[model samples]
Target: MKAWFARDYGRPDVLRLEEVAKPVPKPGEILVKVHATTVNSGDRRIRACDLPPGMKTLGRLALGWSRPRQPVLGTELSGVVEAVGQGVTRFSPGEAVYAFPGGRMGAHAEYVLLKETGPVAHLPEGVDMQTGAALCFGGTTALTFLRRGAVRAGQSMLVLGGAGAVGSAMVQLGKLAGAHVAATTSAGNLDLVRAHGADTVIDYQKTDIARLAERFEVIADTVEAMDFATAQKLLTPNGRYLAIAGTLKEMLGSLRKGPEGKRMIAGPADERIEDIVELGRLAALGQYRPHIDKIYAFTDMPAAHAHVDTGRKRGSVVVQVAQ
Candidate 1:
């Protein structure tokens, strides 16, 4: 087996391809022959050791005191069940599947081990490996956050950084939920956001955030590029601000909001097995679409990471691990 290991924390250059031992599934687990995976924001942040403000030391400790605890960086994958271990009856050999390894990321390779009852699901016959892999990261995150926000139909929603993976998913899901979606992005990516179903697109470079035309029932700042103190004025009463990336200060503020004030929601998306299954169903029905910004070959994993590092991808960046 071969895997791309981040030898150290720094840049995409730190990731190197090395032949390694293939892993077998443990009891209650299944062995997947990875067909495709993605370079998501989580992978980029870990590879670069990027941390939110005031959490640098904590991030280092959680990831590693000096280097990464795990060398492989992918968080989600679409693959085939090569074999199922003893006691695993949910999946059989040759079944196509997709999984979010969550905190146990080891998918940047030719093979991976996943628990049969974990966040793993059989891919729909209509969904290809690339789309399945692409859907895992952003689709799960967007769904998790919107549900947390208690978003409802006919309400207005605002998504900041609307052209990236999570943001694009947010726009599409918001529209699916029947909300009036507004999103912010660079002028170059405005059309991309619109294509994802954002009813109104704000060009961040040209428009002042405070001057936005309408207050929103839900505001999701996916990239942490906006000031919540000022953005709060843009929220309607009883609205919720979904802080996808919150600093320590913002977290504390979130905890201290007045009882009568709009709520501030900040937390990591919980990648649940049920959500994966639901997203898979939606994909099968053609209601959920995974837009690929670029596709890189397995041997070109480094280039894929480099592209993600640029922070400008309109949607998912997928790596084809097998034909």
Candidate 2:
């Protein structure tokens, strides 16, 4: 099997494709011959050892001190089941599936092993492998935060950084939940954001968000650009502030009581089979389509990482791992 390995973190060039032994499924596990995977923001962060403020030591401890704990750096994948281990009756050889390993992080390869009961599900009919590979990370993250914020129909919701992968997902899910969605993005992505169902799109470069008089019942900051103070001012009373990307200080602030009934929601999103299943359902229904910015060949994964590092990618950057 061929896999991309990040032995040391620094630049995109650090990722090297090399021949590695194929993994065999253990008990209750299934081996997948990966067809497509994504190089998302999470991959870029891990590849560069980019940690939020005050989290470097903790990040190093969890990831690696001098090198990555897991050399393969992809988080989600879509593929065909090639083999199944003992007692794995949920899936069989030749079944198409998508799996979100999330922080487990070993999807950047020709083959991946997933537990039958993990965050793995069959690919919805008609959903291509690239789209399947792109769905989980952003979709699951958006769903988790929306649920945490208790977003409901008729309420106003604001999503900052609406052009990126997770941001776009948040906009779509928020609207699907019946909330009137407003999103912020660069001038270039105004149409893109609006196309994702945002009722109002604010051009961050042209309009200052701080000057806006409108307040939202739920404000999701996917760009880590909002401070608690700003969030407090922008949220209506009893509103929820979802810090989808927050600094370490803001993470600790999640423990502190907020003024009035407002609250801050910040933490890692849960990886659940149910969420993946729901995403598949939405895709099948044509209600949720993950935007793909580019597709790179497996051998060009390093270039994919470089593209994601630029911070301007409109959506998920997919890597075609197999034909």
Candidate 3:
């Protein structure tokens, strides 16, 4: 099997493509022949050790002391089950599936193994592998935060960095909930975000998000560009600030302040099979879709990482791993 190994935490250059032994399924695990995967912000952050302030030691401890604890650097994937370990009755050898490997992060290769009980679901009919690979990172993240914010119909929600993976998901999910969605991104992505269902779009480079007159019932910062102070001011009374890409200061502050009026909420998205299943159903029904920015060949993993590092992608950056 071929895999991109992160030799050490640095630039995209550190990711070296090499022939590695294919992973085998353990009991209760299924081995998948990967068809597609993605280069998410989380992958870029981890590969480059882009830690927030006051979190270097903690990040080092959690990720690795000197290097990445997990050498492979991908989170979500769409693949076909090639084999299933003993006792794995839910999946067979030929099932089409997509999964979020979550904290394990081993989807950047031709083959990946996961327990059947993990965040793995059958790819719904009419959902292609490319779309399937793009959903988990954005869908699960946006859905988790929106649910936490208790977003409802007839309310106004603002999505910061609405062109990125999680932000695009926020725009679509907010609209599906019947909320009036406002989004901010680069001027080039305004139409893209709008297509995803944002009723109002703002170009962050041209306009100041803080100076906007309208307030929102839920303000989601998917790019971590907005601090809690500014986001709180933009929130309506009893609103919630959902920070998917928050800094360490905001995280610690949230623990101190807790969930109150215009409260701060910061955490990693929960990876659940139920969420993946729902997203698959929605994609199959054309109610939701991932906006693809680019698709690189499996061997071009380094180039894919570099593109993600540029931070200018319209939506998910996918890497086609196998046919």
Candidate 4:
């Protein structure tokens, strides 16, 4: 099997494509013949082993200390089951599926394994492997924020990176929940975000998000590091301040403030299998869809990583590993 492996963490150049042994399924695990996989900001961050002050120590302890604990970089994948381990009873060979291999990094190859109890779900009817490949992180991340924010009908939502993969999905999810959605993007994506259901568009380059006259009941931010005081000020009372991009300290600070407005903020919600399955249902229902920015051939994993690292992708970046 040919797969991209990370020998030492650094740039996309660190990734070398070579033949490697295909992974086998362990008890309760399923071996998948990968069709496609997608990259996320979290993937890049991990490759670089970039964590905030105290977080680095935690990562070192969990992953590898001196070098990368996991040699492969890909996380979310869409594939077909070639074999199901002994303890696995729900799925059989040849069933199409998708999943997040929770903390492990082997999805960027032709074969990867995961426990059936992980975030595995059958591809939603009419949802092809390409789209399924891209949904795990974007969907779960969006779902988590919306749930934590507890967005309700008729409320207003402001997504900081609306044209982005996760942000675009949030726009759709927020609108489906009956919220008037707004998103921040450059002039290029003004119409695109609107089409996704964002009622208002903020030119983050030209307009000051912190100074917008209209506030929101829920603001979903994926740009990570935004001023808490600024976002908090824009929320309606009992508003939820959700930021997947914000740092741990920021989230904790908002939580501790005990301020009004569900000012409750968080990232990556829970990675429950049910949540992913639910997201697939929503995609099948046309409420949420994969916003693909580009699809690169599996060998071009380096190029894909470079694009994601630039933080300029319009949506998710898909890597076609096999199909």
**lDDT (Cα atoms) of all candidates against the true structure:** 0.89, 0.93, 0.90, 0.81
Residue 227 displacement in candidate 4 (angstroms):
1.2
- RMSD to truth, every model: 1.2, 0.8, 1.5, 1.9
Give lDDT tens digits, candidate 1, residues 1-323: 99999979988989999998889888998999999999988999999998887889988888987789998989999999999899998999999999999778989999999889898999998899999998878888899989989999999999999999899989988899999999999999998888888999999999887777689988999988676676678888888888887777677777866344788888778878988998899899888887899999999998998999888887999999999
Best by lDDT: 2
Minimum summed lDDT over a 10-residue window in model 3 is located at 253-262
lDDT of 4 at 300: 90
Worst-scoring 10-residue span by lDDT in model 1: 251-260
Candidate 2 residue lDDT tens string, 251-295: 788887588888898999988888999999999999999999999
Q: What is the TM-score of candidate 1? A: 0.97
Candidate closest to the true structure, highest TM-score? 2
TM-score of 3: 0.97
TM-scores, one per candidate: 0.97, 0.99, 0.97, 0.93
For the record, the alpha-carbon RMSD of candidate 2 to the native fold, in angstroms, is 0.8
Residue clash pairs of candidate 3:
none
Q: Which candidate, 2 or 4, would have the higher TM-score against the true structure? A: 2
lDDT of 1 at 190: 90
